[model samples]
Target chain A: MIPVLEAPPRAPSLDIDCELAAAWLVAFLRDEMIERRNVRRAVVGLSGGVDSAVTAYLCARALGAENVTCVRMPYRTSSTDSLDDARAVTEALGCVERTIEIAGAVDGYLVNEPDADGRRRGNVMARTRMIVLFDQSAKLGALPIGTGNKTERLMGYFTWHADDSPPLNPIGDLFKTQVWALARHLGVPERIVAKAPSADLEANQTDENDLGITYLEADRILSLMLAGYADAKIAARGFAPADVALVRGKVDGTHWKRHLPTTAMLSNTAINEFYLRPVDF
Target chain B: MKLAIVQAKPRKGDVEANFAALGEVFAQLASEERPYDAIVLPEAALTGYFLEGGVYELAFETEALAARIAALWRAAPGASRAPVDVVVGFFENAGGTFYNAALYLEIAEASHRIVHVHRKMFLPTYGVFDEERFLSRGRHLAAFDTRFGRMAMLICEDAWHAIMPTLAAIKGARVLVVPSASPGRGFAAGGELESVAHWRNVLQSYAVEHGMFVIYAGLAGFEGGKGMTGSSALIDPFGDTVARLPALGAAVLRAEIDFSEIDVARARLPLLGDLGSVLPDLLFDDDLMPENVRRGGERPVTP
Candidate 1:
């Protein structure tokens, strides 16, 4: 739930009704948006970091501490730091927590598949985590609340349907770096925010390490690009040509992943138009 | 004209329950001898939204529901004298595809006609909204040539895109109706609701800039897993709230909006014509943003 920043609406002529934000947005999303729709409980995959930390906090806030549960499914290659962080976060958020060590689970799954690239292995771990989450969500009358931040979403840093596919995402728009900003705002533990971001599926595998360049750099580049600046202009904003090229390429490659599968329109009228009518009527 | 904006919670995934709730409200209004000019409801009223299905599955028993609703509307006080147009939100199945639609029925005819159907054009994928996953977005804008006046209605996200309302206004719409199931603020640490002044002001600005009356009907009460607060109301041509719902559920706020105010605003400002002349190429990125710079300027677009 992105706030209005207590600022005026962009259109001076239009009033944004931000008072409703203070009065309604969270309650609407928490009670009616999730619960009335049959999401009786919320299941979160806590990584112990600020993004997940904040997401967990918000889940507890929205669904109540009892209805909020966390699964810390660590792999064999996962870090002890992540486990500790996860525990700390769950404790702080005041939600129920469980640990389902996935080494045995992954071994069973990998028996049919090749080990392949370590990167692909991480994705496999991620997807495996989702399988557990969805199954639990169903069994417990809960909906998975995703913790992927805006930076991860924009770069396609997450496995498709893994860490995505939440009934509701509380922090999907804030960038990784901005996530830290919001974490501070939410009174998140500094130790969690101070550390580098990792998928925790392997050793020495931080997010920026996999992609190259820190979130601080990536967000800066992304913001410039979204602002509709020319590539050279974005480079002028203080990015190395190679850095800009890499991030831009990542965005372009990931763009299709973010949107619906496009259909070729040979006829004047399309059969399935997703956006054609007004909302309230 | 007496406009009644109904802000209430519709039972999620239960069309029969929702229609019954609406019927209860209508019956109550009918007994009060209160002649309402129009009864406006929240977006996608009958089909509690976000069902996991394709458009075909979303197809509702609108015809049967309409017949029952039309009867109650016709019998409603002042409906025949001045005429009451019951504007409702429902799932409309067209050629096996369902759309989020607004059905307007004139109580005098006892028939529910689609005077306007604003399919939400911009399916907000971000935030809590997942319109793209369920409902089909609208293609063409719908403006109603009603007994009340030339009017247009926009579905939730459609209001975010001024293009729909602008097209309707060009089609002679003097008033705009927006119905939304907007995610509202939750109970925070301080027990404080977040600020939504930005969006409320946006509506006011839309009304003022277009020199048209803007009526927003929001779904109130908790639905799904979240709670909702009703701020449903009207923004006159002068960008002032004429009437509004007081709480989150089952509120009926009424007001008399003057169309002459639109005419006066148009005569005074006339910003639309000037706004139309602004060229896309002339605008730059910094021309927008409207916040602390997230990043520096752009590099260049590589071919």
Candidate 2:
């Protein structure tokens, strides 16, 4: 007698080979920064999160610990644990560390608009941190390396032009869960890896709470959605349809944020419009 | 015959700098204990791969290309005394139309001559590739005689199509040299980049199926953050890897290969012979034959 058999579940995974990813990312940073651009030192903004810690570790590995400078930019409302975790990363890597308080700089412009919302204040602080980071980079002749992960960038959770301002980014292509996996593989501190991610712009601001989904869920949904899967197909893979819709909405709606500003193309030589050149060119 | 695969990382839009760098590599190879009979470099070895509209500015005219390479060979320190063949990929400006082409040069102690030039046949226009937008397509394919034996060259995307290699094999090419600037992507497969793993399979299959030696030189380094995977390899006629470079970096890999292995492989398998005998009939099938030929009016001339 013939028997019917059930198919195996098709659960999606954001899993990557951490060893290969680390090696490729290290080589990428070394080539893009030291060899291609002829810059040996790197400046990374440390937010005491897994993403920043992984970036710091990669930078140290690529350019050596002596060439990486970790800057901790905290606002008045930032948690002390955040600062401690950032210090722990610097100590673990044996790289240069600096703590720059941006309360005065962010408040200087924010004082004129007391009615500004939390988002406005957070963006100001983010821009202020970038200003300080760029100034420090110029002072040391070091290039600023971006620490934003693919999940946050795709979700449009970063401050436009501020959090994504750096000219070199080794972790931009990695998803949040994938970055955490890489952090653990690189021997990052378990405290930073295990803690809930936050921007540290305000109190009790957890990323999962803000995004309404866990990073595991977001990464899985994103991996499937970005591969051109329909929402129904993604939902069929044991994900909630609402969550898939949310992730898809964020990814599709934030397309403009991922590109340079649109230019008016009145001629054949319009910059970034008609005329084209590779980024390195 | 001894062969060397040079996985090079050329600077973007810099022809003179790349030429000088290649000269250094040539000089280094010359001083080695064993001299190589042939050396192969990756596609767009003079200018980086993703030039877009910048190809117009960086392309070299046919005469200038031969002259520059000759000068580079002559000026290289510790130049090899024996005649050596070097295959290089470059953007060419031929009769006002630009093409992505490979130049085969035979260099001796006092003079150098152009052996052949193979313009890239397939210009990938999908995904990360925009070659068709910037370069003209090649219209011909032929196997040329070299000191090492009869050989053919296929640029990066051209090798992806099976017809290119089959045609080369049918044209009596004993060796296939592929110069590539393939960007590394798709790492979900495990240990190496998926592109690298896939390339390994493709290269081994080609070597085994055609019973021809495959020498692949892949570009290294980054262009616009896209890393060119460097898994340059020398595969023997039996689909064995004789030498290989690392997955990423600019390096030279050298190996001494026996040309007699091609004869042994073909003697045992004879896949090329089998394919050649059946290809004409397959081309003349109902679906493939021209209307006149299908109607038994006239047989088309075969090139």
Candidate 3:
């Protein structure tokens, strides 16, 4: 009989300070809004999950609560508890709130394709939510803030160009564990912080269950890999070989999603080559 | 010896505010059980470097500024517990002339001593730097004795010249402290900043050539839309980066430097011994040109 492999023992702590992380993100968001984006207002899609909740809180702190607009976009299959958690965050942050139902737009696309799989429906839902968020951003004169964390982004857990289409992201550099740490430091609700992370795209869908890996183990492996550790060395550190192979495959497969669109170079002076200016400038 | 290198973003034209921020970092360090022999800060850490119109107003008198830093050090909880030296950079106003300077302060029990001050010799005046327009150049370069060893100080541009570190080595300095306010520029294919790679190369070359520990402490944050690359690092005599801080934000990095590595490196490769023979031939020569070459006339072509 084959034995089941368990994850390696967790590291004691990540190398981060919640207080400093919170302060830096707030300052970065403020600078991005006032200095770079030239917009006084910011709009964030607040899911019940920790990522969006923390992002909304940071936006509220960076820009004033009056200038931040929190949007809760839920599909028909989205859980009721997720909406309640989103409302809890908006009320706690004292920001303007809007609820945009994405069920009609998503189902309208899925109606013709009755045999569509779960992945297709999930992509449609994510794209529909993005459309609503962007349209609301134009109406409110606010820039859309991204809520994707580094862990999910690295593992290709998010729909490319759909959930990853925002112009700016505050927590993009932070891992999932770091996000929870910063969320607690920023006074996010304990219930929201403790809740299992989910996309709420389909019924009874949890991130860990879908990915078949807990965030704690995934973050530890990802950090080591990103720090230039080889796969053999990572597996020698007590991580299961299957887990390491899975992570390496995901990261390698998602390489195209993380970069800008490839442009064919026709001349010496390309668009992004010769003519370049900093985003802030 | 244990050392802490701080890469901080100074509020432009605000000296007191920058001091307060440094004071907070010191307080935080004090709470830790770790003991450091010295703390190194970036160039012009008190006042941002690119202040075009406010140079004179922000320059500090040596004694007055020393007293303020002494007060902050004495107030820190670790000052009484452990004797720690601080190396910081600031704009100096002496005899109505402004010069970029590095100050080394020794904080002992109940006393804050101003040990040495090394003004920057090379004031960069090219593209983004115009230090000569508002500041006077330093006239001398020397190494001083410290608790760690004989250490020398050099501001940003001074370290760029290979001759400056050579001079320090000639003066029996084993450690070189460089405080920099370099702006970030250029990008490579891997998306890493070119300035970071350039600075790493510069630091490694000096450390390997001199068999000395090189500390490159740089500033963080943006001023006038130009961001300072905060790749503050500690390099061993073997040219390996022992410790490094990230490139964008304010951070305090701590690492212990082993002085005994200098002896090991020097014994393995005696570059200094080779320099002893090479210096005289380069310095004492009266005529470096050929006899046929005249002062003002064109030289005859050799057949």
Candidate 4:
């Protein structure tokens, strides 16, 4: 485990011009789908969160409302407000909407393992949602557009091979803070943006409550650390040392989750070492 | 001199839209504290290169294009310090013939001058390139004086020819600027674009061999289903990459180049010093060849 710093780092300015960012994201989504993927339709999993809402909005603008589909995968413990927010996004964007409950699929596996904890149950739910999303993708003949933001990705806050399983992601580069900014820019409802961020894995669980650090603080430290700043320098920027260490530890510990499964390199003709091609190609 | 290379995507067949985008980029750069002496944009930046049927309509006259570009520079936010020279690629319409050309503009406080226009000499006609079909080819290859220093411009294919850079160096050019719109092709096993790697090799060789600064500004984003490799870079006299923009995106890369490096490298290598003696042998001469080969009818014996 990485050692904890003495103090938390101050939040750095990570503001992005919403109009320019919206235009770029819209173009990227449209180009990646039509030019690269050869598909005009897009499917997004909306959890009544800012990331998904903003991604769905951008997709609607890119591929048009007729080409975008918003899927809501709610568990038994999922909040009613989450469902409302997801529906609101689809309605506002004038895109098609579908809701497929994961309670039956998740409980089918959990029934055999009575001692399965919240983390295990949550993984099962996330993966089940992914399965449903992909199924709906096939049914709708659209690409699965991901809503995972950069901050959550860098800190390994997302479930491996589950929430990050989409083929194309528009918000993967934007930090969580930037996503909120963009959400507001895209005219996303204030209720969704102001709501406390949650994975909805369990009842009454918030992301900050679980991580023990605000995204503003985490994003600042992560950006600095990724930019090649030393911990000493980051600490000098008024970040609490404990929060810094915790954020650093999460990023360092989850390195494996960010990349493809490591293949043993016994020969030069290894898969990644030879016969490589871009996924879009 | 400080130079900035803009790796940007151009709207195909829309010169007005591209000009507006370029103006925004210039304004963004001007707002920064970094002082740039020269700005290099990608080949056919004003009118995208792959416009097979629209080249005639998109091509601009030199005088009108210069006036519009001057207005953009004049409207930039930064106050005038030293004259910032701009090297931009465009489709030029001269006497009803269209040519792929690079226009060099020297922008001053209240006025701008069109210094030199280097038309692309070698029109590529093979494999994804169909330049000779629509555009007329250029004839001359020469270097011209700029506010920063003596420089030469090459549009895409011209830089690939050895004679172009050699001739530019012989013409007392210390800086070689290449504007390209080459499509991205072939990915290596490690997921790197092979076209970018190939360009780095090609550009670096010219910089190191001639002991001159080579600036290669490649277009970014997709055009006609082909992704342009945006490896716009500035290579120093020592063949070191001073600055490089990331591939497949729009960016402005800045770097400071010391002109003295040319003198320092040439003094150490002495390749240019021996060129005078080697030129005589390189020139084609029928008498220097075998009798059978010189007749142009018979094949010469190997032995």
Candidate 5:
């Protein structure tokens, strides 16, 4: 239950019409997946988090429960509760569910790199899961659905090509706070919705703690910054200067991740670098 | 006069496929027992919008376009011999220069006539739109005579400016058809899409201010993740929406165009007449106009 505040410290400017957003996203999924890609089935990686759970629900709504295949891939150190939560989502949605233990696959590669840090191991596990998702999608003739949200995407918190690999994402443009609101509207499991967001890469790892800022504060600052607000103005609006700077740095540093690999433009007819054509074209 | 507005979703960079689909639409409408006097399609109905460098290949000459459309109408089954006025937008290639234009054609069973063509005057070059880079802007605006009544056409960005509608009204146009290809954006606060709401507000204001029937034809479908807003509508001269399509997907909306409503609105408001009387003097008055406008130059001078 949300605590009702007579007067909150600050109202967020990220409110969206959940009803309209749901309809639009559902249609978007159908358009891109069904009509454009000529596929009626979806393969989604369910991490027991709000983002993946919401994506599962939308996939079920768009392509029906029978056509949506939810894959839960857990590394050796992944929380068991996360597996249980992911199972609960499949059960609630009545969609097909599969479990693939990625411990062996990730560990087989890491055995050679004994001095690898947690970040490297985490990336390995993420890419291992992506491999399973793509293979499963090919086996079932289904398309993989993306679940990255705007907050994590803008902060560049996702695994480079692993977490953001899918060609279509229904919730990529929504902020994390807004995704929570959408989850509630879509009747997502309350346990998943209320839990602290995590990549579940290591023990006692939480997203807010790693970023040194809460999602609420990060979303507010990022929204303002994206609207062309100066850093000083954002700090003047009661956001901590350090917090604003941190968010700005992460966003500015991750510009390469959001775009395709740059191509050398030798002539005016170069692909994507000079000779531009729309994706649909 | 009864009008039919088609919110079409053209395949990107494929004119043949779009024309085939449009042919099906004409056949479907012509098969109806109650014939329509006119049909209005959205801008870039034959070639999808947002084609950065693909417009050159898709652009068609006016005569070729007419010939193709006439062939399609002639081939469509159950089409009546009575002429049907069609207003559809396309990418036009005149000699070597290309432009974003709309054509007013009277399609019949055996013959077709190109009534008038309105090239887009205001090419939006900001934000997601990069029209001015690819196509040349139009120079003139005029109202032409039709079988049903005197009508005028304005491409999407042209209607965004108030002067376009005012000039069309002054030229004795009782009906204004605006072919638009606007993408949906800004979902903060309002229950509706912000772009759709803004279009409704401006279209209604233009209708009421000029006392003419405004028919808006909007494009629907996604191109490179940019979804076109499909809230096509018909607003009467009294600022009332007679018919409207949904905010998503392709659809066809039919509404009766009662020319007498224009008379009622003009008699009640008479704002167009008042503006017309003073527009002549306002155009030539040196003090009232900006120095650059009076000099007919592109740039403004320093005071």
Candidate 6:
């Protein structure tokens, strides 16, 4: 039998405003607990980024910090800088925090083959972090929270096996720049928000560096172009033609990844197709 | 003690054009000296309904359009006092997605400021209205603070959900403004009431139960090829329909609502006080389960 794999989650198309981001977590939890009455607690992956920090803060406000947990899963190469920032958030907000190191588990899985390529090493780190998060979530009876911001998700930059859990996300709609703005609003440390972001799997890894453009430029271009503004109008916003082309290609080519897996003879509930439904999806 | 409704048909996909058209109407009203305590407009007044457009096709330039609409509010004032607060519909793009929006316009002397903008939260994906197809549903349910009494806004499907208006009133909103667009032909498809009465009944019940006034405004045009039939009305905190619009045509509903009546009605009726009463032994197995009731735990037995 072929193994069934859950696709990694993609970020939302819109660049969410900070107020909306905080409001969504606030509203979802409030309605669920007050209206639905099933919710008692919330759990999140605190990556020390602005997105996760703000989500964590909102979850605490929505569910009370006593009922919220912040899980920090750090890889061996993961910098102490981010870990400290994550701790600062938990401590400042009076939230519970736990640490699970994944370097040993990932290192044990890799044969090294005399010398492994960078891609293999990075996958090992990304997948292992997800494994750690899910394992703890199951043990604690908590939901795993997603940490990817919208820009990375739009470009299909997240690892599938690690980040996509059906009900585990609270920050998928915010863009990278908006994430920074939210982090400041939530009182996260400046160093965490100001530094160039990275996955910490390699010596020099940053989202913009890998995407070949910064989020501020990409979001402006994507937002404007998506709004049907002319290329000339978008370029006037300080983006190079190459940057625009690269982002446009990424958005177009990976559009399939944003959708569900397609197949012939699609049903109302086909894997990746949209159709009429008896109930709301 | 007089009220006025400003019902204008929205142009498809042109917010700037719609704003211009509204300016003309406001000018005409000013010239005629048609003074009103408050003016209510349709949902998505800025950008016409995007029931068909996907994320890539919708217009979300709310930042640019708000100033223009606010300028129109600046043009209209009540009787030289605190000025009228105009409650109109528009599309907002604060979160990188098009939202079905309602704006509260308050004219202070010569300047009209948008005090609150409410986004449509409950997106209807089924039937003729596929709002989930374009804009992001809102996360806020509380009403805005306006001179028209602590007023709040709800769009289309939001009135059906009790929490949106309930939270608004709890947050100090005395008046709830619901802007709706009901499909005409779909009203009775094969003798099934497709959300026509549901819209009116839900808002009316919520107003009476919560002791809050409900000002419902619906678009008077055929939206999304669905041929929208208008059924706008104002329901007081007593669950009685105070004023209903014409059975079928372009008409702005105006009514005199004294919010001071709410406290007296509630004090006399005291129906909402029973909200906290528990029927632990009786199980309500019905289509409607007040969201709070479904989260079941055995009620403590009192001796």
Per DockQ, the best of the predicted structures is 2
Q: Per-candidate RMSD vs. true structure?
A: 10.3, 4.0, 13.4, 15.9, 4.0, 24.2
CAPRI quality band, candidate 6: incorrect
Compose the digit string of candidate 4's lDDT tens values, residues B1-303: 777899978766656777788889888878878667888898888766777646777788988888888789778778356688888898899979999999999888778899999999899998777788788999888789887679899888888878788889888888999999988654321345556778888888888888999999998776644667778998988888888887667888888888888999888877866775687776556755666356645676678
TM-score of candidate 1 on Cα atoms, chains taken together = 0.66
Candidate 1 residue lDDT tens string, B1-303:
678888867765556787677777876666656577788987767665555343345465556546767876665444445456777777777666667777676655534564555565666776556566666777777676888788888877788766666676666788988887775543222333342344477788888887889888887665444444457888888778777665466688778876788889888888755555553433445655545343444544559
| Fraction of true interface contacts that also occur in model 4 | 0.00
Q: A53-150, model 4: which lDDT tens digit per residue? A: 99999999998998998989998899998999999998898999988889899999899999999999999999998898888889878899888999
- Best-first order by DockQ: 2, 5, 1, 3, 4, 6
Error of 5 at A263 (Å): 2.1
A150-223 in candidate 1: lDDT tens per residue? 77888888888777867577666556766676666566788998998887777887888888888888888887
DockQ score of each predicted structure, in the order shown? 0.11, 0.67, 0.02, 0.02, 0.63, 0.01
After TM-score superposition, the amount by which residue A163's alpha carbon in candidate 5 deviates from its true location, in angstroms, is 1.5
Interface RMSD of each: 9.8, 1.1, 11.3, 13.9, 1.2, 18.6
DockQ-wise, the better of 5 and 6 is 5
In candidate 6, list every pair of residues with a backbone clash: A8-A160, A11-A153, A260-A272, B45-B89, B121-B138, B143-B152
Compose the digit string of candidate 2's lDDT tens values, residues B87-107.
889899997899999999988
| Best candidate according to TM-score | 2
Supply candidate 1's per-residue lDDT for B102: 70
Model with the higher TM-score, candidate 2 or 6: 2
Q: Using lDDT as the measure, which candidate wins?
A: 5
Model 6: DockQ vs. true structure = 0.01
fnat, candidate 6?
Answer: 0.00
Relative to the real complex, the DockQ score for model 2 comes to: 0.67
**Sorted by lDDT, highest first, which candidate order results?**
5, 2, 3, 4, 1, 6
**lDDT of candidate 5 over A1-281, digit per residue (tens):** 99986976553479988988888888888887776778999999999999999999999999999999999999889999899999989999999999999999998999999999999999999899899999999999999999999999999999989999998899998999999999999999999999999999998889999888999999999999988889998899999999999999999999988988877778878987657788878
User: Candidate 1 or 4, higher TM-score?
Assistant: 1
Which candidate, 2 or 4, has the higher lDDT? 2
